[model samples]
Target: MGSAVRIARETTEQVLAEWGVGPQEPCTGPVLLILSELVANSVRHAAVLSPKVTVIFAGGPDAFAFGVHDRHPYRPALYSPAVAGSGRGLATVMELTLELGGSAVVRGDADEGGKSIWVTLPLRRSGAPGAR
Candidate 1:
Protein backbone atom coordinates (compact mmCIF):
# COMPACT_ATOMS: atom_id res chain seq x y z
CA MET A 1 0.00 0.00 0.00
CA GLY A 2 2.82 2.39 0.77
CA SER A 3 4.39 1.68 -2.59
CA ALA A 4 1.04 2.11 -4.26
CA VAL A 5 0.62 5.55 -2.76
CA ARG A 6 4.16 6.57 -3.61
CA ILE A 7 3.88 5.39 -7.18
CA ALA A 8 0.56 7.11 -7.63
CA ARG A 9 1.91 10.35 -6.21
CA GLU A 10 4.98 10.30 -8.38
CA THR A 11 3.03 9.51 -11.51
CA THR A 12 0.47 12.16 -10.70
CA GLU A 13 3.19 14.70 -10.17
CA GLN A 14 4.63 13.91 -13.58
CA VAL A 15 1.23 14.16 -15.22
CA LEU A 16 0.47 17.44 -13.53
CA ALA A 17 3.80 18.84 -14.63
CA GLU A 18 3.08 17.73 -18.16
CA TRP A 19 -0.18 19.66 -17.95
CA GLY A 20 1.72 22.76 -16.73
CA VAL A 21 0.51 22.54 -13.14
CA GLY A 22 3.52 23.62 -11.17
CA PRO A 23 4.34 22.31 -7.72
CA GLN A 24 3.38 25.69 -6.25
CA GLU A 25 -0.09 25.61 -7.69
CA PRO A 26 -2.85 25.84 -5.10
CA CYS A 27 -4.60 22.69 -6.19
CA THR A 28 -1.49 20.52 -6.52
CA GLY A 29 -1.10 19.43 -2.92
CA PRO A 30 -4.76 18.71 -2.40
CA VAL A 31 -4.84 16.77 -5.64
CA LEU A 32 -1.98 14.52 -4.53
CA LEU A 33 -3.44 14.13 -1.05
CA ILE A 34 -6.82 13.21 -2.43
CA LEU A 35 -5.22 10.62 -4.70
CA SER A 36 -3.33 9.16 -1.76
CA GLU A 37 -6.43 8.85 0.37
CA LEU A 38 -8.35 7.21 -2.47
CA VAL A 39 -5.57 4.71 -3.16
CA ALA A 40 -5.29 3.87 0.51
CA ASN A 41 -9.00 3.23 0.74
CA SER A 42 -8.88 0.88 -2.22
CA VAL A 43 -6.00 -1.05 -0.69
CA ARG A 44 -7.60 -1.26 2.71
CA HIS A 45 -11.16 -2.12 1.73
CA ALA A 46 -11.21 -3.27 -1.88
CA ALA A 47 -8.01 -5.29 -2.30
CA VAL A 48 -9.72 -8.52 -1.43
CA LEU A 49 -11.95 -8.29 -4.44
CA SER A 50 -9.78 -6.12 -6.64
CA PRO A 51 -6.17 -7.04 -7.04
CA LYS A 52 -5.41 -4.12 -9.28
CA VAL A 53 -6.22 -0.47 -8.76
CA THR A 54 -6.26 2.13 -11.49
CA VAL A 55 -5.65 5.83 -11.21
CA ILE A 56 -6.91 8.09 -13.94
CA PHE A 57 -5.89 11.70 -14.56
CA ALA A 58 -7.37 14.32 -16.84
CA GLY A 59 -6.91 18.04 -17.16
CA GLY A 60 -7.92 20.97 -19.32
CA PRO A 61 -7.15 24.67 -19.29
CA ASP A 62 -10.00 25.26 -16.86
CA ALA A 63 -10.29 22.05 -14.86
CA PHE A 64 -8.27 19.11 -13.56
CA ALA A 65 -9.75 15.73 -12.80
CA PHE A 66 -8.77 12.29 -11.53
CA GLY A 67 -10.36 9.04 -10.56
CA VAL A 68 -9.50 5.96 -8.49
CA HIS A 69 -10.95 2.70 -9.63
CA ASP A 70 -11.18 -0.82 -8.24
CA ARG A 71 -13.09 -4.02 -8.84
CA HIS A 72 -14.93 -3.97 -5.51
CA PRO A 73 -18.63 -3.54 -5.98
CA TYR A 74 -19.24 -1.46 -2.88
CA ARG A 75 -19.91 2.22 -3.47
CA PRO A 76 -19.10 4.30 -0.42
CA ALA A 77 -21.25 7.15 0.78
CA LEU A 78 -19.02 10.18 0.39
CA TYR A 79 -20.79 12.44 2.90
CA SER A 80 -21.71 9.87 5.48
CA PRO A 81 -20.64 10.53 9.03
CA ALA A 82 -17.27 9.01 9.81
CA VAL A 83 -17.59 5.66 11.51
CA ALA A 84 -14.54 5.91 13.66
CA GLY A 85 -11.69 5.23 11.19
CA SER A 86 -13.77 3.56 8.58
CA GLY A 87 -15.25 6.50 6.73
CA ARG A 88 -12.74 9.30 6.89
CA GLY A 89 -10.90 8.64 3.63
CA LEU A 90 -13.64 9.62 1.20
CA ALA A 91 -14.79 12.29 3.60
CA THR A 92 -11.40 13.98 3.47
CA VAL A 93 -11.35 13.67 -0.30
CA MET A 94 -14.76 15.28 -0.50
CA GLU A 95 -13.86 18.06 1.91
CA LEU A 96 -10.71 19.15 0.11
CA THR A 97 -12.30 18.80 -3.29
CA LEU A 98 -15.31 20.91 -2.39
CA GLU A 99 -13.17 23.47 -0.62
CA LEU A 100 -11.24 23.97 -3.85
CA GLY A 101 -14.38 24.53 -5.92
CA GLY A 102 -14.44 20.95 -7.12
CA SER A 103 -16.96 18.13 -7.36
CA ALA A 104 -16.80 14.35 -7.06
CA VAL A 105 -18.86 11.51 -8.40
CA VAL A 106 -18.93 7.72 -8.42
CA ARG A 107 -19.39 5.85 -11.67
CA GLY A 108 -19.98 2.15 -12.09
CA ASP A 109 -18.08 0.24 -14.72
CA ALA A 110 -20.52 -1.23 -17.16
CA ASP A 111 -18.25 -4.07 -18.25
CA GLU A 112 -17.12 -4.85 -14.74
CA GLY A 113 -18.54 -4.98 -11.23
CA GLY A 114 -16.47 -2.17 -9.74
CA LYS A 115 -16.61 1.60 -9.53
CA SER A 116 -14.53 4.71 -10.05
CA ILE A 117 -14.64 7.79 -7.85
CA TRP A 118 -13.78 10.88 -9.89
CA VAL A 119 -12.97 14.36 -8.62
CA THR A 120 -12.78 17.53 -10.67
CA LEU A 121 -11.38 20.89 -9.55
CA PRO A 122 -11.39 24.28 -11.16
CA LEU A 123 -7.96 25.57 -12.07
CA ARG A 124 -7.16 28.97 -10.66
CA ARG A 125 -4.20 31.03 -11.67
CA SER A 126 -1.33 31.14 -9.17
CA GLY A 127 -1.96 34.64 -7.81
CA ALA A 128 -5.71 34.72 -8.14
CA PRO A 129 -7.94 35.27 -5.13
CA GLY A 130 -8.51 32.06 -3.16
CA ALA A 131 -5.74 30.43 -5.18
CA ARG A 132 -4.18 29.09 -2.06
Candidate 2:
Protein backbone atom coordinates (compact mmCIF):
# COMPACT_ATOMS: atom_id res chain seq x y z
CA MET A 1 0.00 0.00 0.00
CA GLY A 2 2.74 2.40 0.88
CA SER A 3 4.58 1.67 -2.32
CA ALA A 4 1.48 2.04 -4.41
CA VAL A 5 0.68 5.27 -2.65
CA ARG A 6 4.16 6.59 -3.31
CA ILE A 7 3.97 5.73 -6.98
CA ALA A 8 0.56 7.39 -7.29
CA ARG A 9 1.66 10.48 -5.40
CA GLU A 10 4.72 10.78 -7.60
CA THR A 11 2.78 10.16 -10.76
CA THR A 12 0.08 12.63 -9.81
CA GLU A 13 2.65 15.26 -8.98
CA GLN A 14 4.30 14.75 -12.34
CA VAL A 15 1.12 14.52 -14.37
CA LEU A 16 -0.56 17.51 -12.73
CA ALA A 17 2.60 19.52 -13.06
CA GLU A 18 2.67 18.80 -16.77
CA TRP A 19 -0.98 19.80 -16.99
CA GLY A 20 -0.21 23.23 -15.51
CA VAL A 21 -1.22 22.43 -11.94
CA GLY A 22 1.64 23.67 -9.83
CA PRO A 23 3.14 22.28 -6.64
CA GLN A 24 0.44 23.76 -4.40
CA GLU A 25 -2.85 23.77 -6.27
CA PRO A 26 -3.46 20.26 -7.58
CA CYS A 27 -0.98 18.59 -5.26
CA THR A 28 -2.77 19.11 -2.00
CA GLY A 29 -2.23 16.67 0.90
CA PRO A 30 -5.81 15.46 1.34
CA VAL A 31 -6.12 14.97 -2.39
CA LEU A 32 -2.94 12.89 -2.39
CA LEU A 33 -4.26 10.81 0.50
CA ILE A 34 -7.51 10.15 -1.32
CA LEU A 35 -5.66 9.00 -4.41
CA SER A 36 -3.39 6.89 -2.27
CA GLU A 37 -6.38 5.16 -0.78
CA LEU A 38 -7.84 4.50 -4.21
CA VAL A 39 -4.59 3.00 -5.44
CA ALA A 40 -4.33 0.84 -2.37
CA ASN A 41 -7.84 -0.46 -2.90
CA SER A 42 -7.02 -1.38 -6.48
CA VAL A 43 -3.91 -3.19 -5.40
CA ARG A 44 -5.80 -5.25 -2.87
CA HIS A 45 -9.13 -5.95 -4.55
CA ALA A 46 -8.81 -5.55 -8.31
CA ALA A 47 -8.35 -9.36 -8.22
CA VAL A 48 -5.61 -9.26 -10.81
CA LEU A 49 -2.24 -10.27 -9.58
CA SER A 50 0.54 -8.07 -10.94
CA PRO A 51 -2.11 -5.56 -11.94
CA LYS A 52 -0.83 -2.19 -13.02
CA VAL A 53 -2.28 1.19 -12.14
CA THR A 54 -2.22 4.17 -14.41
CA VAL A 55 -2.98 7.80 -13.67
CA ILE A 56 -4.16 10.51 -15.96
CA PHE A 57 -5.05 14.16 -15.39
CA ALA A 58 -7.12 16.10 -17.85
CA GLY A 59 -9.45 19.12 -17.72
CA GLY A 60 -10.06 22.72 -18.50
CA PRO A 61 -10.91 25.63 -16.21
CA ASP A 62 -13.95 24.12 -14.57
CA ALA A 63 -12.43 20.88 -13.30
CA PHE A 64 -9.56 18.43 -13.26
CA ALA A 65 -10.34 14.84 -14.10
CA PHE A 66 -8.27 12.26 -12.22
CA GLY A 67 -8.33 8.66 -13.31
CA VAL A 68 -6.81 5.37 -12.09
CA HIS A 69 -6.83 2.11 -13.97
CA ASP A 70 -6.33 -1.50 -12.93
CA ARG A 71 -6.58 -4.94 -14.55
CA HIS A 72 -10.01 -6.06 -13.44
CA PRO A 73 -13.38 -5.74 -15.08
CA TYR A 74 -15.19 -5.48 -11.77
CA ARG A 75 -16.41 -2.03 -10.86
CA PRO A 76 -16.84 -0.62 -7.41
CA ALA A 77 -20.17 0.52 -6.04
CA LEU A 78 -20.66 3.40 -3.68
CA TYR A 79 -21.00 2.37 -0.04
CA SER A 80 -22.11 4.32 2.99
CA PRO A 81 -19.70 5.59 5.62
CA ALA A 82 -21.32 3.36 8.25
CA VAL A 83 -20.36 0.11 6.50
CA ALA A 84 -16.95 -0.35 8.15
CA GLY A 85 -13.41 -0.69 6.71
CA SER A 86 -14.14 -2.69 3.58
CA GLY A 87 -16.84 -0.20 2.58
CA ARG A 88 -15.21 3.10 3.38
CA GLY A 89 -13.07 3.30 0.23
CA LEU A 90 -15.68 4.46 -2.22
CA ALA A 91 -17.39 6.57 0.38
CA THR A 92 -14.20 8.39 1.16
CA VAL A 93 -13.61 8.80 -2.57
CA MET A 94 -17.05 10.31 -3.05
CA GLU A 95 -16.58 12.59 -0.10
CA LEU A 96 -13.25 13.81 -1.43
CA THR A 97 -14.72 14.24 -4.89
CA LEU A 98 -17.65 16.25 -3.56
CA GLU A 99 -15.44 18.23 -1.23
CA LEU A 100 -13.35 19.16 -4.26
CA GLY A 101 -16.45 20.56 -5.94
CA GLY A 102 -16.64 17.92 -8.64
CA SER A 103 -17.83 14.39 -9.42
CA ALA A 104 -16.57 10.78 -9.64
CA VAL A 105 -17.26 7.43 -11.31
CA VAL A 106 -16.17 3.78 -11.38
CA ARG A 107 -16.65 1.81 -14.56
CA GLY A 108 -16.10 -1.76 -15.68
CA ASP A 109 -14.64 -2.63 -19.07
CA ALA A 110 -14.48 -6.03 -20.67
CA ASP A 111 -12.83 -4.61 -23.73
CA GLU A 112 -9.61 -4.17 -21.84
CA GLY A 113 -10.54 -6.57 -19.11
CA GLY A 114 -10.08 -3.94 -16.45
CA LYS A 115 -11.72 -1.18 -14.47
CA SER A 116 -11.12 2.51 -14.21
CA ILE A 117 -12.06 4.65 -11.23
CA TRP A 118 -12.05 8.37 -11.68
CA VAL A 119 -12.79 11.67 -10.02
CA THR A 120 -12.91 15.25 -11.16
CA LEU A 121 -11.88 17.92 -8.71
CA PRO A 122 -12.50 21.59 -9.31
CA LEU A 123 -10.28 24.45 -8.47
CA ARG A 124 -11.38 26.61 -5.56
CA ARG A 125 -11.44 30.40 -5.75
CA SER A 126 -8.07 30.48 -7.44
CA GLY A 127 -9.70 31.19 -10.79
CA ALA A 128 -7.89 28.05 -11.85
CA PRO A 129 -10.64 25.40 -11.93
CA GLY A 130 -12.68 24.02 -8.97
CA ALA A 131 -11.34 23.04 -5.56
CA ARG A 132 -8.54 23.99 -3.19
Candidate 3:
Protein backbone atom coordinates (compact mmCIF):
# COMPACT_ATOMS: atom_id res chain seq x y z
CA MET A 1 0.00 0.00 0.00
CA GLY A 2 2.75 2.41 0.87
CA SER A 3 4.60 1.77 -2.36
CA ALA A 4 1.42 2.10 -4.39
CA VAL A 5 0.59 5.38 -2.71
CA ARG A 6 4.04 6.72 -3.41
CA ILE A 7 3.85 5.74 -7.06
CA ALA A 8 0.45 7.33 -7.42
CA ARG A 9 1.61 10.54 -5.79
CA GLU A 10 4.72 10.72 -7.95
CA THR A 11 2.66 10.04 -11.08
CA THR A 12 0.15 12.72 -10.18
CA GLU A 13 2.89 15.23 -9.51
CA GLN A 14 4.52 14.47 -12.81
CA VAL A 15 1.25 14.81 -14.66
CA LEU A 16 0.32 18.08 -12.99
CA ALA A 17 3.74 19.50 -13.76
CA GLU A 18 3.47 18.37 -17.34
CA TRP A 19 0.11 20.08 -17.56
CA GLY A 20 1.90 23.28 -16.50
CA VAL A 21 0.05 23.23 -13.18
CA GLY A 22 2.35 24.23 -10.39
CA PRO A 23 2.77 22.17 -7.24
CA GLN A 24 0.93 24.80 -5.21
CA GLU A 25 -2.10 24.61 -7.45
CA PRO A 26 -5.28 24.06 -5.42
CA CYS A 27 -6.20 20.77 -7.04
CA THR A 28 -2.83 19.13 -6.41
CA GLY A 29 -3.51 18.17 -2.82
CA PRO A 30 -6.99 16.82 -3.32
CA VAL A 31 -5.86 15.00 -6.42
CA LEU A 32 -3.04 13.32 -4.50
CA LEU A 33 -5.36 12.40 -1.66
CA ILE A 34 -7.88 10.90 -4.03
CA LEU A 35 -5.21 8.88 -5.77
CA SER A 36 -3.91 7.56 -2.46
CA GLU A 37 -7.32 6.37 -1.33
CA LEU A 38 -8.03 4.67 -4.63
CA VAL A 39 -4.67 2.95 -4.73
CA ALA A 40 -4.88 1.89 -1.11
CA ASN A 41 -8.27 0.35 -1.69
CA SER A 42 -6.88 -1.58 -4.60
CA VAL A 43 -4.10 -2.92 -2.45
CA ARG A 44 -6.36 -3.80 0.46
CA HIS A 45 -9.51 -5.22 -1.04
CA ALA A 46 -8.76 -5.87 -4.68
CA ALA A 47 -5.55 -7.81 -4.64
CA VAL A 48 -5.33 -11.22 -6.23
CA LEU A 49 -2.13 -13.04 -5.36
CA SER A 50 0.50 -10.51 -6.48
CA PRO A 51 -2.18 -7.81 -6.85
CA LYS A 52 -2.34 -6.29 -10.27
CA VAL A 53 -3.13 -2.56 -10.22
CA THR A 54 -3.04 -0.31 -13.22
CA VAL A 55 -3.41 3.44 -13.00
CA ILE A 56 -4.15 5.76 -15.88
CA PHE A 57 -4.08 9.53 -16.05
CA ALA A 58 -5.56 11.48 -18.90
CA GLY A 59 -6.70 15.04 -19.50
CA GLY A 60 -8.48 17.26 -21.93
CA PRO A 61 -7.96 20.99 -22.25
CA ASP A 62 -10.14 21.64 -19.20
CA ALA A 63 -10.50 18.43 -17.21
CA PHE A 64 -8.48 15.45 -16.06
CA ALA A 65 -9.48 11.87 -15.40
CA PHE A 66 -7.72 9.31 -13.22
CA GLY A 67 -8.50 5.66 -12.79
CA VAL A 68 -7.18 2.57 -11.03
CA HIS A 69 -7.87 -0.93 -12.23
CA ASP A 70 -7.62 -3.92 -9.95
CA ARG A 71 -8.03 -7.65 -10.21
CA HIS A 72 -11.08 -8.02 -8.01
CA PRO A 73 -14.50 -8.47 -9.52
CA TYR A 74 -16.54 -7.33 -6.53
CA ARG A 75 -18.09 -3.90 -6.76
CA PRO A 76 -16.90 -1.54 -4.04
CA ALA A 77 -19.22 -0.83 -1.15
CA LEU A 78 -19.72 2.34 0.85
CA TYR A 79 -19.93 2.08 4.63
CA SER A 80 -21.10 4.63 7.11
CA PRO A 81 -18.47 6.31 9.27
CA ALA A 82 -19.75 4.32 12.21
CA VAL A 83 -18.64 1.17 10.45
CA ALA A 84 -15.05 1.93 11.31
CA GLY A 85 -12.59 1.37 8.46
CA SER A 86 -15.25 -0.06 6.22
CA GLY A 87 -16.32 2.81 3.97
CA ARG A 88 -13.80 5.60 4.03
CA GLY A 89 -11.89 4.80 0.86
CA LEU A 90 -14.62 4.96 -1.77
CA ALA A 91 -16.49 7.56 0.23
CA THR A 92 -13.53 9.88 0.50
CA VAL A 93 -12.81 9.52 -3.19
CA MET A 94 -16.41 10.38 -4.03
CA GLU A 95 -16.58 13.28 -1.62
CA LEU A 96 -13.38 14.86 -2.87
CA THR A 97 -14.31 14.27 -6.45
CA LEU A 98 -17.57 16.16 -5.96
CA GLU A 99 -15.86 18.85 -3.97
CA LEU A 100 -13.59 19.41 -6.95
CA GLY A 101 -16.67 19.81 -9.17
CA GLY A 102 -16.19 16.35 -10.53
CA SER A 103 -17.68 12.85 -10.25
CA ALA A 104 -16.59 9.24 -9.76
CA VAL A 105 -17.54 5.82 -11.02
CA VAL A 106 -16.64 2.16 -10.37
CA ARG A 107 -17.24 -0.67 -12.74
CA GLY A 108 -16.63 -4.41 -12.50
CA ASP A 109 -15.79 -6.22 -15.68
CA ALA A 110 -17.08 -9.77 -15.46
CA ASP A 111 -15.03 -10.91 -18.40
CA GLU A 112 -11.88 -9.59 -16.84
CA GLY A 113 -12.72 -10.56 -13.28
CA GLY A 114 -11.81 -7.17 -11.88
CA LYS A 115 -12.90 -3.57 -11.42
CA SER A 116 -11.70 -0.04 -12.01
CA ILE A 117 -12.59 3.16 -10.19
CA TRP A 118 -12.33 6.50 -11.91
CA VAL A 119 -12.69 10.16 -10.98
CA THR A 120 -12.82 13.23 -13.21
CA LEU A 121 -12.16 16.79 -12.08
CA PRO A 122 -12.34 20.13 -13.76
CA LEU A 123 -9.15 22.03 -14.53
CA ARG A 124 -10.59 25.45 -13.81
CA ARG A 125 -13.45 27.09 -11.93
CA SER A 126 -15.10 28.12 -15.16
CA GLY A 127 -15.69 24.38 -15.56
CA ALA A 128 -14.61 21.82 -18.07
CA PRO A 129 -16.67 21.10 -21.14
CA GLY A 130 -18.97 18.09 -20.53
CA ALA A 131 -17.95 17.91 -16.86
CA ARG A 132 -20.66 16.84 -14.48
Winning model by lDDT: 1
Which 10 successive residues of model 1 have the least lDDT summed? 79-88
RMSD score of candidate 1 (Å): 1.9
TM-scores for all predictions: 0.90, 0.77, 0.82
For 14-130, candidate 3 gives per-residue lDDT tens digits of 988898765676677788888888888888876764277898898976778898888777766533354246666677777777777887777777786877787888776223344
> TM-score: which is higher, 1 or 2?
1
lDDT for each candidate structure: 0.87, 0.70, 0.76
> Candidate 3 at residue 74, lDDT?
74
Position 14, candidate 2: lDDT: 79
Clashing pairs in 2: 122-130, 122-131, 123-129, 123-130, 123-131, 124-130, 124-131
Q: Which runs of model 2 end up more than 4 angstroms from their true locations?
A: 47-50, 79-85, 110-112, 125-132
Cα-lDDT of candidate 3: 0.76
Candidate order by TM-score, highest to lowest?
Answer: 1, 3, 2
Name the better of 1 and 3 by TM-score.
1
How far is each candidate from the true structure, as Cα RMSD in Å? 1.9, 3.0, 3.9
On lDDT, who's better, 1 or 2?
1
Question: What ranking of all candidate models by lDDT puts the best one first?
Answer: 1, 3, 2
Model 1 whole-model lDDT (C-alpha atoms):
0.87
